[model samples]
Target: MATTEAVKAKTLLGECAAEFAGTFILILFGCGVVAQVVAGGIGDHDSIAWAWGLGVTMGIYVAGRMTGAHLNPAVTIALAAFRGFSWRKVLPYSLAQFLGAFLAALVVRWNYTEALNKFDPGLTRKSQIVFSTLPGNGSTELGVHLWGGFRDQIIGTAILMLLILAITDLRNTAPAANLAPFIVGLVVVGIGMAWGTNAGYAINPARDFGPRLASFLTGYGGAFKDQWGDLYFWVPIVAPILGALLGALLYDLLVGRFLPISDEDEEPGRIPEENTSA
Candidate 1:
C-alpha cells in the first residue's frame, strides 16, 4: 500500500509538472510575440497568429506523453464531461496552468518593461492589452460592445473545441503518425485569423486570467475590469468553459455517436480487458 501510494503521488506530481511546463512554454512564445508587436514593433497579426499556433504545438509536444497535455482548464473540464477524464484532476491542472501562465507573464513583463514604458509610459490598461484581451474598436455604431465580444468568445472557443475533437478523433479522420498536436496548433492559427481581433480570441482562461492577475499586481489596477464599464474578466473564463462543453456535445452528437466506444468510456477504475492466460 505504501509503494502504491508513493507511485500515485509521483505520478500526480509529474502530471502537474508537465501541465505547468506546457503552459509556461505556451505563454512564453504566444505572449512574447504580442509584446514584440505591441512594444518592439516587430510583427503583425499574422505573426501573433503563428506564434500562438507554434506555442500550443510545442506545449503539447512537451506534455502530450504525460497527463494528455491539457493546458487549458476548459479542455480539462470538457474532457471530464465528454471524454471521460477524471473529475479529480481538474482543479490541480487548472492551478498549475495558472501558475505557469502567471510566471511566464512576469518574465515577459520584465523583458519588455522599458519598451512598455516607451510605448505607453504608465502601465495602464492600454498597454496591458499585451497581456489581456478587450472588445473591438467600433467599426460600426459605438463599437462591437461587450455582448458581441462575449458572443465571439463563445463561438470562437466552441470552434476550437470542436476542431480539437475532430482532429484528435481517430475514427473520424484524425491525423496519422502522432501529428494531432501540430494539427491542433493549426486550428489555433485558423481561429486567431478569424477571431483574434475581437477580444483577442482568448479561448483559454489561464491564457488570459493569469496574466491579467499579474498585471493587476504590477500596478494595472483592477485588471479584470476596465474603465469602459466592462466586467470583462469573467467573459474569457466562463465563455470558454461553456463553449468547450457545447462543442464537445456537438461532436458527440454528430460524430462521436457513430464511433466505437472503447475502454476509455469505462469509469475511472473499471476498465475491462480480455484475459488470455492458460
Candidate 2:
C-alpha cells in the first residue's frame, strides 16, 4: 500500500518538478565544464564531452523514478510522439526543462563571472559562447553557415533519439540493472566526440535556448545572433525538435514495430515488475 501510494504521489506537478531538477543537474555540470574550458582554461574538448555525458547520467539517476528524466525537451517531445507519454504534459514538461536550464545557466554565469570577465573583458559575443552554442563553433575558418548548422543539429539530434529508443526498448537489448542511463550517457559522449565541432552538438533545444536566453538577459545582448550578425538562435531550437520527431518515427518504423511483445516485457523505461515493490 505504501509503495502504491508513493507511486501515486508522482503527480504531474511532481513529475515536472523532477524534470526541472534533473535538467538543472544536467546543465549545471555540462555548462560548468564548458565555462571552465572557455573562461578558466582548465579543460579541453574531451573534458567538456565527458563532463556533459556524466552530467546526463547523473541527471537521469536523479529523476528517473518519478519522470524517467526526460531532461531534454527533445526527449520529452519525442517520447510523447513515439511512446505512450501524455501529449498534454509536453508543454508543461518542456517549460519546466527550459526553466531548469535557464536557472542553471544563470548559476554557471554567477560562479564564473570573474573568469569570464577576465577572459573576454567586455562580455562580447565571444563570451556568450560560454553560455550558449555558436555556429561553426565560433570558428571563422570553418565558414559553417545557417544551413550547415541546421543540418548538423538535425543529424546529431536524430542520432540521439534513435539510440535512446534503441537503448530503452525492452524488446531490444536494453541494459540490465539500471545501466541504461550510463549507456545513454556514453551515447551522448560519442555524439559529442563525433559531431560537436560543427555546431556544438546541441541536440537538445532547451539546452541551447535556455542558456542563450539567460545570456541575452545578462550583458550579452547579442545572444540571439552569431558573430557574423546572423540570427542563428532558431537553428538549434527548430532543428532538434524536427530531428527528434524524425528519429522517433524512424525507430518505430524500422525497429519498434518489428519487435515481438512478451509477458515479461515492460514499457520503454520502466523497471521490471518484480522490482516495482522493492
TM-score of each: 0.91, 0.92
| Candidate 1, residue 241: how far the Cα is off, in Å | 0.2
Per-residue CA lDDT of candidate 2, range 1-278, in tens? 88776774456677789889999999999999999998898989999999999989999999888777888888888887777676777888899999999999999999998999899888886778777888888888899887889999998999999999999888999899999999999999999999998899989888999999987887887889886889999999999999988898889899989999887665653334433322
lDDT string, candidate 1, 62-142, tens digits? 988776677899888898888667677788889999999999998998898899889878777667778887776223343
lDDT to native, each model = 0.81, 0.86
Worst 10 residues of 1 by lDDT: 269-278
lDDT of 2: 0.86
Cα lDDT, model 2, residue 157: 94
- Tell me the TM-score of model 1: 0.91
lDDT of 2 at 225: 87
